[model samples]
Target: MPVARPETSDARVIAHVDMDCFYVQVEQRKQPELRGLPTAVVQYNEWQGGALIAVSYEARSCGVKRSMRGEEATAACPEIQLVQVPVARGKADLNTYRSAGSEVVSILARSGRCERASIDEVYLDLTDAAESMLADAPPESLESIDEEALKSHILGMSREDGDDFKKSVRDWICRKGADRRDKLLGCGIIIVAELRKQVLKETEFSCSAGIAHNKMLAKLASGMNKPAQQTVVPYSAVQELLSSLPIKKMKQLGGKLGTSLQTDFGIDTVGDLLQFSETKLQEHYGVNTGTWLWNIARGISGEEVQGRLLPKSHGSGKTFPGPRALRSLSNVQHWLNQLCEELYERLSSDLEQNKRIASTLTLHASAFGSKDSDSHKKFPSKSCPLRYGVTKIQEDAFNLFQAALREYMGPFGTKPQGNKKETWRITGLSVSASKIVDIPSGTSSIMRYFQSQSTIPSCSTSGCLQEDVAVTPSASESCSEQKSVETQAAMPEEDISITDTLPDLDNSYGNMDMVPEKDVSCQSNDAKEFLTQSGSNRGTQTKTNGQRINNSKEKNKGMPSIVDIFKNYNATPQSQQETREDSTVSLTSKRANLSSSTSHSSEVNQEGEDRRETEWGYKVGEIDQAVFDELPYEIQREFRSFLRHNKRPNAGKSKGDGSASSSIAHYFPPLKK
Candidate 1:
């Protein structure tokens, strides 16, 4: 289900560049002898010469296609050379091609905002570049265009006996008095041609590009011209190009969607789609998709090319067909370990090279029960928190598989513990890491800053935060000094040698709460800061613990602490009859508290002001508990210390807090500064 966007304005220049038979090109670069020959790159050569993933232009001319097996390709062209894709961990490896794609992206990114659409495709928004070119060096002023630009295939331009096609393209590209939009598109063509040449010169790879006003048009035009050539979609030629085009030839409508349009309304061409009213289309499809179809028929699309160079997620997987299916838990665990190993290697490289960490690990399996006649039972997919070690990933993957297996095999199906033969066979398995985030330096001690400002919310509207918790520093420790100490965690501590406590953190458990709860305490440098600062402020009177006790007793009773304010904020609403009475009482109580504690109130206000400056805010309910549980115990302990204040509650306090601490701190050492 795709949502329709606003109508296109054709104000931007977009280009889509696709590599021609990318896998074959990478192999050709490895062995120069295969450059001019009919070659095809295949994977798993042991199975019927493997499956052809890419076919050379020379091979395509000899009736060989990408879907054809190596045997069929060689039969069609006896001189055809077949190459196998690299294999690692019992699965096909595409790292070489991925690296090559990166080289191409590095070159293309120099022009403008570039988006890597796939391993061999990219979309670039060259609006600013084209506008700058038109302003600085308009195409009409040049005596002649670049040779590569002139070689572009212009849509709707007919080829005649006298080579009129080239002249038509040349005149249109350098048209003396064309519209500003057309001139901008011409500039885009020249820029794309230049980028293609750079890719070829630097990486020894050839590609084709399409220049148009939007991504859809660019994608359609890019495929029009094959291998080593570019195409330009002029505004005036758009109608003619699409009027007689088949609906299935369009970018997104080539599959089931196109078949639906043809079967439902007898629509076979783009021109036929225009016959139905927007309202009529809306009645057939939902409002979003209906309006989208109507606009695309008029040569309009508003999809923008995003600015990204890296993939959103990393995944490794393989399939076991029929007799090769995995039956025993040990067999499944072995394959899962291999997949996790590959995933971890890629993750380590990303962390080392890009300073990023992935936060979620997901497992997907394809299997069906053998004993049950209803083999249609589907394998459930499961995901957990992603940690940085290979052993952790393998453990988590095995857990996810077990969870999915339980759901896949219902009550009547064979259970894993049964002594009988295994009933469920795993035909495919995959593990992917997603929700990646970049880790910038100097963000280590953010928890101290939150505590110092009293900006931490003791209780949130979401039920996750309980209202009875309280955390407050000694009376001698002013809010201002706490702010200064907050900066300590940002750097290495000079006193305590608790270096092990600060193991390079990867991610916090879900969304970290702003304030600490009662009965929880941080014994890091931050806690010591309160002790040191309090002692200095009180004239260095007595022993550290003795002075702390005295300050707690002498603290002003009239001043409202963070805990009091949080309790008031979380107060329940009354019924309509008692609303007025409750409001009056609340107002009177608040005014009295503010007047007696003006300084403390000001600190609270300042904290609120600082929080307002943030770009995003989250509610406690939005946090995922399962994902949080999967986080490393060290991270969980640190985050819990920040969220809960150090306060020993009375005997009536809930027992749940102690249980939580015991579980999270089981694998973590005592907190040290």
Candidate 2:
């Protein structure tokens, strides 16, 4: 039998803080007159504009539900306020909402680990803060009357003083001479009350929370009493809670798995899952998922909650509606530019605040359903050692989209047979970055002053810290960095030494996405696809360690990452491409070869048929070793270290590979300062 390791006490404290009706709340906060009114945050007013992203609770009471068509909402509640979901530059405008989310997250992050899970959700590891607060409660509003009366009445009931108001409620339960069930219920109510008060006071926003021994339990409980309530689950209550709970309620058990549990194994409730053997589950689901299901069934999650405020990745996107849909590549590109710009601003902020760099860039587009529902496309992600300037980010992101589009259009189900309607309008478009890490080496100048006041994690020998985001080098400085990078790209192999700063290429591993269990983890949407060698004609090479990712569409399914592509992109001419002048011609030639010679494109051409062998211009196989050896010390160093960080975790290899392969695996393993 495999024993699950208990979550370590000091490992990390994670909290999932979800605002109540976030979009509606945003509107209500800005315009208090909207309070208690049936309000909804809508997007795309046309027939295709998806219904409400958010509707106030009051609207819900009035039979107004999210994703309800604006027309339907109006019909149900004539007085309902249906505000457009705001669009900017041809897409769903989310800037105002995102900004609001950031503010709430900043407030929540004040005392501990934090992650912004979504536009209106965040996670906090408030073990320290909670413990501190448990030591005291707010002063009474009045000294004489029912103020103490209220407190005493609260305390005398439960005859218990818990970590927070919950303990007082527990006492109330005792006063009622309640059973374990009643006591538990009282505790839950108190927890919700205390948390709600704290959130309102601290963030000027109201939120709901769940308190439990672990994240899964807490998360599950959090939703039970929503908006301005909290739920507490003691260790003893886990099994009872899971027994009758609907299987669908468990996170990650959506769609197929839920169906399978119901139809195949008759495991309608989480409790039923325990009847099957781990091996039996494997025989049904694949390996990775089977193991995951087994673990989650046992209430065991090895997931870590990251400590970050900025999104792990930045994404900008929009959906087209009705006749205003896209007509040509030019139109699509126009929208893509808008999305990329938004992503760039976010990336810039990350660089400014954390001095970190996004390791990859990816694009996604969904065409009109009337055109072809089968046409779900993902663009090839390209990344290079992330450069600081917005120009670099934008240029690279745009190019990556072109490459992805070429691949998606060709391999996926081809244009509806005979229907040449450019109305193949896109319903959604988004760009994201993944595998982000703090800038290499020490604290940024902005952070230096606060360094002594706060504790920072230790950095590698070369000095890369998780706290330093990339600084946008000024125009002249950016030019200088580029020249330095190009110069280093031209350096001789013999003259260069791969330092700890430089990620060792041999240690590269396929992309392994880490899904943070907390609010403050990596921000961006699966931080979109990315690869290296900027110029274009980019493609992908994959490696699956036999751990087949269950869903190919999900981000970071253990594929060779964009960084791996960059290493290939920057190869020296003698090793792959031939040299030009003093440096290897890899970047130039690689860009040229991007569209041609890629076999992977055929795979995504939708259906398995109608193959077209597009000739990408670059032949990466000919890039040289000297080119990599030569590069400005800083960029080269950063790239090398970035690779190292990503590869640190999976240092262990499969069966016959031995220690050499395992030792070569690069992972992003963070350690306490």
Candidate 3:
């Protein structure tokens, strides 16, 4: 087992940059005339302008929300201009975003090691950049606090700006004698300030930045301000910022564990946790999580954001509301095809650019909570192996749905007990692919292994598998590799469901318990607070009070063995010609059943104008064509035959019960209790 390690303390300069209302800003920049108005970026304006995903700060104050329906947004602020998400492949496209992001990345990468966090966020390690600046010419303290102090600090700074000083300083720093740490640091600050300005000017994007010694603090501080602002988190500012903070406000804390903390120990404020011993906390939680909580209370976090230009998986989805409920499998199948098309196009792009191969395909469907939910077909993530292509995704996704439905048809599946076959309209559909890695075609196994080992990002916390990786360490003392052991040591033991994850503990919601907003019959509102609620009204935990039936097998297992098949199926996929032929036949038959069963309830036009053609697509390489071509023609034929035989299913009927906007983040607990 990998033993707990200490947090990194290495002195490094890291910066987190987030563009202000990026999509809105992107729209604003292109149109210019839309500047300063209460504008928002909507996803699908054609049909009620799919919900407003990103609203400007000005709009936010008007009760505008991310997933609020377009109609609701207009109701909130009558004058809000709803700009639609760029259309491609007969639906929303984000290529303009990718293009805009690349431009910003090129400029941000000008400093040291840079990591693009998301479509609108970036992290840069400025250690070398700062060192070089100091070597060539010292930094001038631009702000004047006092005449004497300012003059003293700027006594030897270079008069001019730009990266020139960086190169010049680098040349001299190597030869200069010891004790130049302070000197190097002073110059780095100057470089960062200038770099921030360049991004604003060059990219026409307003951004806020946090410069620290590590990734966590940088991320934390970056959100301090938005729309052209930056904050510097010196080691001195650590305690003041972290102390007295709400425990849930810390990143990774706003999940189930955070709720559990408040429930089990009444540890509300981060400072409150400080009152307890780390050992006691561990006893309450688990080893890893308990220790993690302790270190974070002390302003310590070691998670690193890796650098990557593309998403690990591409997904397209939407949530269903009233009047749009999918009542049949046909509706679900139709929507699934549209979604599959989007996923396939994205996969095509990845294959073209990175020559990478995706080994897994996942399906997420939601249904109103019921006995049907306990059925295998009723839950989301009924995923399977996906071939890379539009048709392939359609076929595979539908087959997986059928597979889930077949499981649903079993003995434990949904049964008519009270004539309760109320329409099972889907509220959401999301298709994604994973297991993407660069295809080092000609490299030997040993060589590839060594290359992978060598590729670890040079950071104390997180590491990446690629040459270009994000390794910026926060400036905070607690955000260090040396502190990793202490950080992990402070974690608490926990038991969480696999589906839940940590939520964003940001200004979006403060001290609020993320809860299920919709009133469902099974819920016990007696709980203190939920993510959707405010004040002391939230944060209470509920337990089953009634005696359990002897039927432990039924109550204990929430999901079926069919669901567990995901864990074992990957081990031995086939038994050669014997099962291969029969499996192929079964697969074809099943797919045929699914397609015919899922013929209606489709939405989202699959073909869009902006959808890139497969003929010329490549993601930094030629993986898509070569990888597929290299596979045995027989396998390809079988895959195609299977895809063709399995008809697409309706996407709407699979929609499940749930609110997408509820802030509750559920984290599976650590087993080291």
**Pick by lDDT: which candidate is best?**
1
Instruction: Work out the TM-score per prediction.
Output: 0.68, 0.56, 0.56
Clashing pairs in 1: 516-643, 516-644, 517-644, 517-645, 520-645
lDDT of model 1, residue 85: 95
lDDT for model 1? 0.62
Sort by TM-score, best first. Answer: 1, 3, 2
- The residue-level lDDT of candidate 2 at 124 comes to 59
Model 2 clash count equals 101
The worst-scoring run of ten residues by lDDT in candidate 3 lies at 460-469
Encode model 1's per-residue lDDT on 260-333: one tens digit a residue: 89999899888789999999988998788888888888888888899998888999999998888998766787
* Model 3 RMSD, rounded to 1 decimal: 22.8
Model 3 C-alpha lDDT per residue in residues 506-573, reported as the tens digit of each score: 11111111111121111232321111111111101211111111111111111111112222223332
lDDT for each candidate structure: 0.62, 0.47, 0.49
Q: Report residue 645 deviation for candidate 2 (angstroms).
A: 36
Residue 117 C-alpha lDDT in model 3? 77
